[model samples]
Target chain A: MTAAVETAQTTTIHGDRVSLLRVLGPAHVWALGVGIVLVGEFTGWNFAADKGGALAALIVCWIVGLLYTSVAMIDSEVTSTVAAAGGQYAQAKHIVGPLMAFNVALFLVFAYTMLEVSDAILLGDTIVAKAGVEGLTHNSFIAATIVVLAWLNYRGVLMTLNVNFVITAIAYVSIVVLFFSVSPWTQGAVLKLNELVTPGNALPYGWIGVIAAFQFGIWYYLGIEGTTQAAEEVRSPARSLPYGTMAGMITLLIAAAMTWYVCASLMPWEYLGITYYPLWDAGKLTGSPLLENLLFIATLLAALASANGCINDAARAWFSLGRDRYLPSWFSAVHPRYRTPYRSILFLLPIALAFAFIADLNQAITFSILSGVLQYTFMSINIMMFRKKWPLGSIRRGYTHPFHPLPAIVLFCLCVVTFFAIFLGFGSQLIAMVAFYFLISLWFHFYRYRFVRRGDQFTMPWPKPQGY
Target chain B: MWMALSYACWGISIVLALWMLYDWFKVDTTYSEDMLTSSREGELEAVSEKHRI
Candidate 1:
């Protein structure tokens, strides 16, 4: 009823924990969100063209873009309000229960790690293809990249932020160059939208193809919510969280549109679909080897930047779960000097490498999107629960969703659609996702449930701060 | 029918993006300076306490 009574939830963790240094500002947070996702603009989204052709892929892109917009809006409201290092996991703990929190943590880690693994593999494949390196194994390259990223992450948060900002800037600038160089406007070609619908072309696979395209289309915005994992390191979580997320989403949306339009217009959908690096291929269409080489470097940088952010997010989620005793307490250990989550980052490196070796790019993308949608569904539900549990009048809030329940409800329905897309399009991967959920639930019942000492609690500090 | 649906999806997406942009600038960014700095120390202390546990 009262603000004090509403904020009375237990804010303590029982096990050993280490604080993350708050060195990141709003710009760094934006870089983390966009950098984790910018690679999709360069490579992955073209896969949708194979399934649905240009027109259908464009349609799917619009739908998926809207879905992520809803996700970004709702996540901005919830993350700013909760403001914890755990990100979605912490939000789940406060609004749902520990069981759901455990599940969300696992899903978040799975999604980010899978993205990282995929990027490592893709970067290796790109090097081999672009550099004409003979007999170089993708496995070796992926292993080496993961090790390098892990070391850089272990150094310190500031170094990681600085490196991410530089790589993210290069990736985005490359996209802008691609847009100008290959765009229909620059080439003096009108977009023949009708040409995409020629008999056996547009929806070659029909509505099923459109559904299939959703998975790849989602890659454009998959990692934006990851910015919230930086809550602990952000100077002003309440203000920075929303600003970074929404701004990142807007930038990605524009980038996605430019990418899809330019690539689809410049090249045949069939050729674009098969290429490992679509932006590079699009640059090739301009008959400039120089632009192609530049795009090659950009694509590699995008993958590296994305892998960097993925490691940051997945490590934080692991740290949160470990701190709460969901996993072993050893994972909660922070570097003595760097103050980084060294243990968790090291723990994940081998698993990520192994996943990279076995999983193909398409499988990795679908798996990541599927796991992300699962986590987001719970996040949407948690938003509604938070509002009902602590109404606007009952709590000191910095930012709240303007439409409140509408955005959450929309996000839930969109997530359901995405689930069906992944399920029907990639049936085998869906089974694996189910198995993962089962195993996580088993662990929760056998071990984690016992260690859950706290109830539904919102222990974040409230009231009084402005302009941070 | 598919063409019609595609157009509709594009239209709705455009509207949603515009609405999100408006909400970001109008509602979320309109917080007072008091709300931003009110519990700065308390919030940081709470975060530290959570970690120290």
Candidate 2:
């Protein structure tokens, strides 16, 4: 193969060719994964309580946690082997085809962008609530937060990771504090399993309520997989990716359990069901203004941490696609001194700001979950495909999943169920997701027939040349 | 029926969480070392081939 083809196949940053610096370590990876989903511990999952009561919501969270665990296991193996910045997108390209790859990239970008916008809005509202500033508009705060996060991201990957680490640590410690301070176990309150099932009970809505609550329950573990996007930038991804993802998953599971248990037990399920911010309400249940204030700060920190990680993940996804010529080449440009994807971060900043101002948080979250479920489905399918294409002993294996394709298959099935549940729960958002996919498909087909058929330079980088 | 399902889900999640923790601590790091070594060798070989060309 010619040098040009080799370069094109191996590396994606062309024209003003630049590469990403491997600055992230295992601890950073853990923080990235945990930070992206830590906000779930503060809010969002309470909607599940509304749907299915405390016990039912806890059950749904448990089920979703298992689904994410299976996904993490499979993804660990795939990321260890491929170790690309594009992450699931790159894996899809190699295992499936370019069409699936493009679709996955679009889904990732949509999911992370929506998450970023939603978290920014949540952060602004949290700050206003903490300050007791009535009638103060949060839109300005949202815009300011977006700009600051974008600037921090552009400064360098290390700075962004360091900030995320501190914010994530605070967010996690707050959850532990909340659990110990208010939970029935620590509060000397009577444990009542029987009351959980009494007529007009905690689960007054019934089994259907459990199904209705699945989407909200999913909040606890939604964006953890985005950590793998840093695979190329992490030191020894083969080890760190698995270690980081698994550790983060375990932490999230514990946090989810503690949050659900504490919030559910401290207050009546009926009351917890209606509150938008359950953690804040849990603090209120303590009848202590100081604890409420601390929980308020924790809520803001959680939102900021989640938003920071979303920016990091979204920018890398955009950078990878742009570098690979899936998107415009300008997005691939790395800052000369900082070695960061400044262009892509700037490009996404305005969009996030606009969405934060105008979009409804509930709808944005539903859409984000929709996109995330689709991405997980694709990742699971790609894992199976990779196993078939390159069997266990065929490639220089890093960390092989213990059960081969079982975990992948299970994850795929769970994702399909979750997709249908989300569609049923949020019909309008499902329609929007379908329309978005349709538009993406049209562009992909047009690009393939128009540019690829004509042998243009802008083509999908797949069926990678030998020895790449 | 909902009660049974909730209990089952909780059981499964606890088991899964424990298994993940075990796997996280027990999984070997030697594989990553081998991978890094082999990747460096591959890069060197590629450079040598480029020079010959």
Candidate 3:
């Protein structure tokens, strides 16, 4: 993607953080806490619900989550290193040059935006489908949620999280209730170990299906960095971030796994895969419309709450970029009262809204998966570089992945493979990412012509501290 | 009940995080020098020198 390479933009020490109300500490962040990520109930259930792959899938989730933990841990550390307002893009831009950083910033926003759109589209579809309602435009619902999110965020960051809080609470209640209904009754449905471990224990569909099938599970862990993105605004970065992502992941693991198990035990795999509303399907198997609606609401809340992470996190990324003059000054403009970037809001909202009018659930999912891989790769690299350059002192200096280099190496390689997996999974459509990169290039071209050459050199300078 | 309680615990935590930010971190685009310390004018040049943006 193209970034408006700042030639030598004037420097400003006017970095402002959204009030603490916008920052979260470990006190609030939970592991795998997000329900919307588990929304791909169909895909997750596909493996664990049937095909006798429950045990295998569970092991796979543990493995993948474990692998990702290092990256998540490292991210918490490096991101916390500078309490300054600059986020990943800032860190990358400073480490690399402005141009490279700009490209990364563009890529990060593009990926995050696509992910949000995908979640919105799916949740909308899940809701309508579960209702047995026809003519439901899934993408529209997704798009609409983005609009609402944009609207709420524009009012300020607190509004966005407030919305998330309400939405998440409702969704959590519904999910827990669904669990209650499905758990005790559905327990014991997992395949017998002996049935599989012996000779012809249904040789899995080779490693390809196994890896590709595991992609959805990987996504459940992706947004754990939500706290990292919001680090600067946080009061006590050292403690909040290190634990927040860990908490988020832990929350997701148990919640998602249990949800999968509950659904898997209650119904058949094909049933889970076929319905857009996997949770609702679980309820229906129990023959409860009330329960179905309950799940439907949960799905919606999960998706919306997940979007909260996007609205605050993604915009902040762009806001960070704007602050660096990597993109444009417009994005850096914060509302007088709300303290949030009003500029990026204008940009993000319209595109999300347009996407609502077009595109489908699958497209959003594809975009998210592809972009997510890109962000993960860059973030892992950034952490490794930071650790190599700056020796750690206090946890406040930066949060390091427990094992350090090993996890970083593994995550970096895994991401590279995931990138390849995207092309294989999406085929011709994979070109969309390439196209996105080029489009960003074009944007950079225009941005440079108008800004950089016009004496708006945005090259970030050497590190400067406050206390002298 | 444990699951429900856990979910509730998670919910309260998020709300608390939101509260921590006073909802203002939502507006910060990057961790800039201006953010860490309130407006201490002469520090801009020093802060800039100390931290690489």
The fnat scores of all predictions, in order, read 0.02, 0.00, 0.05
Candidate with better DockQ, 1 vs 2: 1
What TM-score goes with each of the models?
A: 0.83, 0.83, 0.75
Candidate 2 Cα errors over 4 Å, as ranges: A1-17, A183-200, A448-468, B1-53
lDDT of 1 by residue, A279-318 (tens): 8887777788888888889998999999999999999899
**After superposition, candidate 1 runs with Cα above 4 Å error:** A1-18, A186-200, A455-458, A461-468, B1-53
RMSD of each: 13.9, 12.9, 9.6
DockQ of each: 0.02, 0.02, 0.06
Sort candidate 2 into its docking category.
incorrect
Question: Which structure among the candidates has the greatest DockQ?
Answer: 3
Task: Estimate, for each residue in A178-231, the C-alpha lDDT of model 2 and write its tens digit.
Answer: 777654454345334345435577677888788878878889898999889888
Report, for every candidate in turn, its global Cα lDDT versus the true structure.
Answer: 0.75, 0.74, 0.56
lDDT (C-alpha) at residue A83 in model 3 = 43
Clashing pairs in 2: none
Q: Between 2 and 3, whose TM-score is larger?
A: 2
